[model samples]
Target: MCDHHHLRSPAPVGIVDHVSSLSENFAELVETEDYADITFIVDGARFRSHKVILAARSEFFRALLYGGMKESQPGTTEIELQDTPSVAFSALLKYIYTGRMNLVEIQEENLLDILSLSHRFGFVELESSISDYLKAILNIRNVCHIYDLANIYSLTSLCNVCKDYMDRHAQEVLTCDSFLSLSQTSMRDLIARDSFCAPEIEIFRAVSNWAEHNKGQDPTPILEVVRLQLMGMHELLHVVRDTGLVSSDAILDAIRIQTESRDMDLKYRGYQVLEENIATTRLGASVIRGEMKTALLDGDTQNYDLDRGFTRHPIDDNSGHGIVIKLGKPYIINTVKLLLWDKDMRSYSYYIEVSMDDKDYERVIDHTGYLCRSWQKLHFPARVVRYVKVVGTHNTVNRVFHLVSFECFFTTRLFHLDRGLVVPTENVATDKNSALVIEGVSRTRNALINGNTHNYDWDSGYTCHQLGSGAICIQLAQPYVLSTMRLLLWDCDDRSYNFYIEVSTDQQKWVLVVDRRQESCKSWQTFAFDPLPVTFIRIVGTHNTANEVFHCVHFESPADTSVGSLINSVATVSVTSGPPNSPRPAQAQQGPAYPLITVDRGPSLSRSSSSSTSSRSESHQSVATATRVHFPQYYGPPPPPPSAQQQQQPLLPQPPPPQGLPSLHLGHYAGHMLQQQDVPEADRMDIH
Candidate 1:
């Protein structure tokens, strides 16, 4: 039929590229006076333009050119635009006609002017395009200026983009010359943002420099926006006290807030949500060669190279010497992560101090009373810091404190799983092997809380107890508002177990939070419930399909998988002091139950009938040969407790240093005592 139809088909319609030609025709009219019906005189430069074209392209111009305005009158031809730049007007006119702007041809400095015209003329598309272009081109050199212009123009989206850029580069932005040149209003706005990442001290320093640049400008208003309470006592007393920008009463109030209040938010500075490490050499950070004998900023947390870590010694606990890390610039930080020399079970006691200037330091952590091993994640009140000094007060194995790696950063991560100590019930007896005591506590280095799920086999990677005999428990360092938990049940084979979880503030009153006794479970399990202050958690297994023992490989609170798995034990802490008592079970609403989930079976490692005994013997020899750990032993009498009068007196002021050197005063920091509470003797161990 097609052959018979040999009729001529309509000529194929060719697609012509018409848009560019149309754009060119309009572009040609942009600078011409031909058919001109109106004239725009911007900054004394006259632009002969067509009224109909302007009316069609811009709502603002549509009203001004065709509406009942003086310029729209028949007798009116020339219209003067006030406060408008001629170059921007020309660029705007071209865009209006051609609908195209070659950003590569335009100077970055002039883009803001064009953007302003786009906003003023109600060119929504042009405004958006210009904003996007500006965002892509933003850099340390121009972001601050662009932010100011965006704020002035009330460009909400652009302003937020600029703010984000500034936050990520806060240290650089604060130190830039453009930052000092910003107007007082803009300066206050910039520093007041809760998302701003610089520390309070750095903010104060930058603003002070800004104030100096703009002489006669009162700094009180700008300084008021800084979170003074977030500053360490050293910065508060040495750096801010003399500024006179803030009143003495305000400074005292900030000191009171810092010392007496435990409001996490109040002590929190901006950048708490970022996960960037400011202590790495990649970020321009370095350990002071004179203070640290080796490099600890390399981020190598696994290697046991003796020459890779820093070491310091002390004749006694009061020695103030330690390794110091200097950031490339001042950064706001709240967390310090370091690897202890854990080739052995040896434990160490340490404290951390931070300083704006190296001369003045404020203690942020005081773990000298307890034992710590392997990975140590210490959190303190957020502060601006340039130097971090970690001083070891005691090392259970030797006179020297060895640290393998160190990292410092601001983290929005809410869970502090490392602070808890695993407390397996007496039924799950502690493996007496000294190798298992990587920290000061036995079984603290086991698989349950070590964060590793792949390295252990049937004989090791898991902690277990005979079903119905005893339970496994965890005692948090202190009561924390908890609502969720994540755990991995041993699942190298097609086996399932039944278990229940309970939480308690005191060992005498356990509240049932999770009851999986009726449901079979395997692999990773996440449990969530209403948040309550919890100090203890117990998991009791009721049944096991494959064997008489209940095995677990991992556990974490506020379930997060992004937390990097560590090659250590469950808890990194040990209880030197606590009470011993079993809590009677209490009735409570069961946490949300999870449905039974089938886990894919991996190749099973052969089980040993005497796995516990064999694991202990093997671990003992392996650990002893690789590392050494020990129980903490106090060589001297404990320090005297603060007197009631000493506790009542909140401030510890020191004399100002000579010259412009920083004052060594710590203000109320030293007097702000940690409220030591009694620890229950139930199951005391460390979390890995």
Candidate 2:
């Protein structure tokens, strides 16, 4: 009896292995079609399936087979599906049994049909899998078609994915034939998005072209959504006026809004909300130049007036004469926002490259063949980069490349650009109230940092205090090396405010970093100062032109610990090591050591007092143990003499000119502004 009971049971199988085998068994059951109790005739093809399996897997099937539906009645096993394709129903049946479908094996057109059928059959898991697969294959050609399908099916996730892809590649997508072929509903949803970064005029052209292609289709509903108030007066008269798509009355109203000072819509500039721009002055971002530097990261992108931004000549040359942005430290960046000089209708062609070590660079975007204008929001494959260089290959206006503002970021969000600019949410002061201690006597302190830019008016969307009542103070969560600040003064009416800002590490002993008590300020105000350790900021309003109240809509300080270096307009830079026995400066030792690149920017772009002067630290006292370096100024060769034949030649069609090629004409009045500054020999010393 003892010998008969000694045999051991087989070793227990793992749960994963058991489940895999179970799935395989179920899959075999689907192929064998044993004990088939139901049949579906789809597009004239018969499919045998089981009633118990179908009822358990899908609610739609359960209702049709077991519920009070007619298909559940006696002798109703064979049901003909008029709308579904045989191939799509075949795939659906397999997925219902095995819980897996090979999307790669199905054609895209057939897969789209499967997606529709999955929605009808209530196969949510199968629908989601197909939607994700569509996003992976999205391109300029198929994005519009997919977007239309998403809209029709009310697939919110798929619609959002398609919309974001369209917005990121708006300029390219706008030109595709599929864009013109989109349904009116999809077209309305597209142009209505604020995140679409193309110029308002370009959107008008695209819509007008779409309307022309789809004749007999009433475009009144679609045309009503084109945000015509955002278009310029010049575009209204020159481009949109003759289109005949917009009614005469609508055109007049848009033109009137542009001229009226009371309309707030005129001030609404399109900005990307998808990602925060980390390439900022407060984050140690700078436009590195060989000689005289420019304030390309000052956070003031609206001003494209001469002397407001920077320009480089012979950008098409191989000498690497273009814009270089140092992002303070290594950042996982994939997007770059470039505000090209758009005061004119000129377009530019360019390429972008990034580097981690500043030596080995990788080219990411190359639009050197096509023309791009206004706001250029470029996205590339994500990579770790510390340096980004934008090289202009061609300019329709001239040979020189004019860039008003530059920004870079690691965009992870898929939201619309609802805010005033592309300032990162983390860097914005109002994102976390608990982390910041805000103190002030106002209508609502929350309104000041609510991140709402377009909904504000005289009575709402702002924090207000009677003049001289008390200063609005904010205590940061931690100390940061600060240098830049951005604020929006309530501009509902023709009112102005005179205010001053002070920063401090502790509650006591404040330092007046910005003083503007004498001059009037309105709209968006951005200022910068020498970097310092700061945790507290106080805004004191001295007077207001409108009654006795001071109002502020938004305030932000984009500060990071890695922001001690100089990023303002730089004229000269020298990085030298201190004597071996010399002690490092306390400020330098606290964080990363950054070379102070100081320049004489003449007038204060900070809008501070005229008496204020740029502060420069002595080179000897600020130097750390580093090699001394000098960036020499570059003056490009002169352009060739005018010729009738050269004037007729297209700029982009020809092969790139040789290195040291002369720059083309830079307009009549821009010659002096684009000239390279002459650095004195004494200031060009290199010490090691």
Candidate 3:
């Protein structure tokens, strides 16, 4: 058994890739009609194919060709597809037999027809290809027609593209000849949206032009949704009514617009503004202020309108960079909502302001920069104001900004933005789900975001046995204002370790947010800094203060619970309720809470940058609770006695062990440190 071992490929060692050529051979058979068993007639063109192949590929073909009826019998084998085009049918048949589809020859008009035919026959791949092709070529002339088709087929992504295209080309779409063909509902919806690039008055003209196209039909109903007061009083009277299409009620609505538009009343307790026809899905997807709140509530973060992303210019820079909300009436607003763009490589530095009148703005949130796609719930002291403004002054990646949604509220409703946030890890052992942790940690992720502190057991917590400078990172799906991080350290090993903390909006460029690389503890750590928008957060281990292994029990954000109560002293050291020289040890002093004193790595992050030191009174304090956990060590038999041949062979140089770290031992929870008295050898389990 100890003699020798060898590895070899017992069977043929290499296999060539011939699947594509095999598919080509099957493709050729469609043209040759070799072993073909059925014929299909498409718009007078005849195509030959095998019955077994067609039955295998198409559900419709299988049912018609073998469903035990006259069509399944041997006598009549021809299938007539009167609706399919010859070119498309040929392509469809070839795909069924050879797993190949050639779309170069199909014309645009016929492609849509084939798209329908493919669905009728249950050819999934062909249908998807047709839809993708149509989506790519969408332009002003065909978007309206494509939009109608998209709705019919429930092709949501394609329909969204059509809507976005129309949003960017609103002016052209309004004047285009297709505008005359639109139904009243479609025109009304277009006019109601806040995303119109040409402003409110242009929509009035478009309505007038539409009425003229319809022999001067009533345009009053459609025009009522617009803010009539925004137009000059003379323009509303002279140009709008001159069309002879206005009604008495329409004139009344316009008269009310002047007073009603500026009335900031919060009579309604909860604004179900998202349901109003004024904001469509297309509006939710843009940078415009009107659609901002709708998108956030819709929970569709991935879809956004690039054309609507904008920032304000100080001196007529032409940027429409902010959103203004007139809260039906004023209430004391304590919370603001923002869901940043999804994994977008852009950062917007903006502010939140409130005012009784739109002109004299009082800053609610000063200069803040965000790069993550996470939802930010900004809380402030409740202040009464009718108007709210979100203004952007700077952008990191580009002048334009991408925002999935925006929201504001009078009540402070706690929102768990990272309920499903998946944290990414570097140089760590992952369990079955690619989540970082050693074995036995089953519910660590849930413990992190589930808002439960002091929630620990064998099934929850993270352990890393492997050695090196390991770090645990969470990549946010969106940028957010990361104000503080609350960590519940795992003290399973009486061992302690220190690690640096960092953050970044763009993953490639990093900023050192905290230097905790020298702190050691079994207690909770709260690293609170100024509010900064970050897409990535990392915990880089630099040293194991007393042992080799690392353990983390839970992680929580501010929204889950109120900031821990503030303590009198910044660094609070706790002594056990025991006599001096007692069995238990005293806990070290917890670090001081922040008005951060940061140490920058280099000029890469300038002192004046958004992550700069700032004064903020964040309310937080450490939770002091002792818990104990222990892990067993794996034991193996000693190595066999060195063989005569191994002893004779000269030793080779071994790889150098990792340097720059102190040596240590493991396995003792924070709650139960080792007793001062040594354990008896007999009681200790030693198998090595």
Candidate 4:
């Protein structure tokens, strides 16, 4: 209606406005629909929902698809979200809708939050994905925080990943505060994984520098954390020392902690270091020069080569310069004695040195002249030295100098302050009349004899008798606390026998703690007694009449006291008879009085009745009897007669069966025999 240009512009503007309005309406409708409904169909069967829906679903759904959810019960939801963040929901929905996530926008804090939710919901796939993301982003700056998050959620896998990443970049992370924080939070876990070595050195170095700068001020919280972490790495003791940051208190603390942990390697290293620093009372040296000669030596001399620049001299009469040995390690020589040559006596002077180098040598000990003879003995006080050089300055020259050996004994200034109990030396006697009689002996056989002779008897078919009439009185030099006793008994007749054990404080008094007469015993029965405090124990023969002998006796004490307690408590009672279930019954019982007793071999009996009518009639009767026999004495060969060769054999005796009972037999009879029996059937009851 107006100008032509104005009409054309208005038409175009109207078209653009209509298109814009339509596009807005379409987008709104798409947003309102379920995310699943909007699917991208790339192939006929391959369809993905819109990203919004994918991202909005909880991790539980991902876990189900990934095979992480084990149980899929109806009416049970694996995950439930309450007030989930808008961003998380949006991200989930976007993934569902588009099958892609904007990983760049996700921060570690948010990632961890989501990961926790995923783990809780059993979305194993999402949890793994988040873990991978964490690994990629882990750095010196953020590792400490990630470690904390892992610990808080009990995500051991994540924590391990973080530790590995930290260990790999230890040098770079040394100055990082986050690393320190991590060290403080989970030192034990890191130590358990052996992940702290590399980082620990770096941390020590950094802390040392910090300590120097701070001039003894309390270490920063970071340094303290580093120190705590180092405490767990006991093997890093030398590394800490090398860093020059280790304090006396710190070293001691480290030792205490390591000892409590019972880490053998750490404990060994600690001892090595401590020993190296402290002077020992025993002196030791290795030959460093010249050829060493020895007498009565039968091995290849080449195998005994000294350290570099040394050689062994062939066995000769004498007159060779002894190899000079230097002792750099401090030790105390307790005794000095040389191997006996058994040849003519040879005199030699030993030159000792205090310090020596290639350029200079200083003698701390004047030539201590000593005689080289058989059975020569010497003892000197402990000495401290940086070097101990021994040289045979003079000896019988070239006269077949039967040089057997040379040794200088010295004691250390310090010994292990705490000493363990010394094991009592076992002195076994083979004499039958001696206080102790050992039988059926092995290398480890030992026995403690109390004054009472009847207390213990060997059941292994061996006998031990005291040398004198007096009972073998085994007296402890001192009393000890006992915890346990073991006895090995042997049955010879292939029959089991029960025995009694008695304990006593005074040699004259006794108490019976075990009463096992009714139970069948074995050839080798181990009896353990409850721990008790006593000085004397006597094992007397209770059941066996056959000579009961003890093979080996072992006594163990919780604390060192008397050998008597240990030997009495721990012993072996070997029997000559077989184990239980042989030819012997367990116990003896009284039999019933009966006449016309009939014994049936099988388990049951049957009889037939007969009737007659003519001139006479007869009656039939049946009777049975079962009897068990008991033996009072063991039926076995007596111990061999004493002889020189027989004396060497230890006595292991077999215990005898219960005494005062004869073997019983069952019999059955009818008619004539029954009527003539002393006891009538009317007044007798059948017994077996």
Superposed Cα deviation of residue 374, candidate 3 (Å): 19
TM-score, predicted candidate 1 vs. hidden true structure: 0.53
TM-score of 4: 0.30
User: Candidate 3 lDDT, tens digit per residue, 263-299?
Assistant: 3331111222211221223333222243434443454
Model 1 misses residue 442 by how many Å?
19
Candidate 4 has an lDDT of: 0.38
lDDT of 2: 0.63
Ranking by lDDT: 2, 1, 3, 4
TM-scores of all models? Answer: 0.53, 0.44, 0.43, 0.30
Please report how far candidate 3 places residue 129 from its true position, in Å. Answer: 3.4
Q: How close to the true structure is residue 280 of candidate 3, measured as C-alpha lDDT? A: 26
Model 1, 298-337: lDDT tens per residue?
6666665655555454526535757787888767887888
Q: TM-score: which candidate is best?
A: 1
- Model 4, 108-161: lDDT tens per residue? 666666666556655566667777788788877888778777877777888878
Residue pairs with backbone overlap in model 2: 273-417, 276-424, 571-599
In order, candidate lDDTs are 0.63, 0.63, 0.51, 0.38
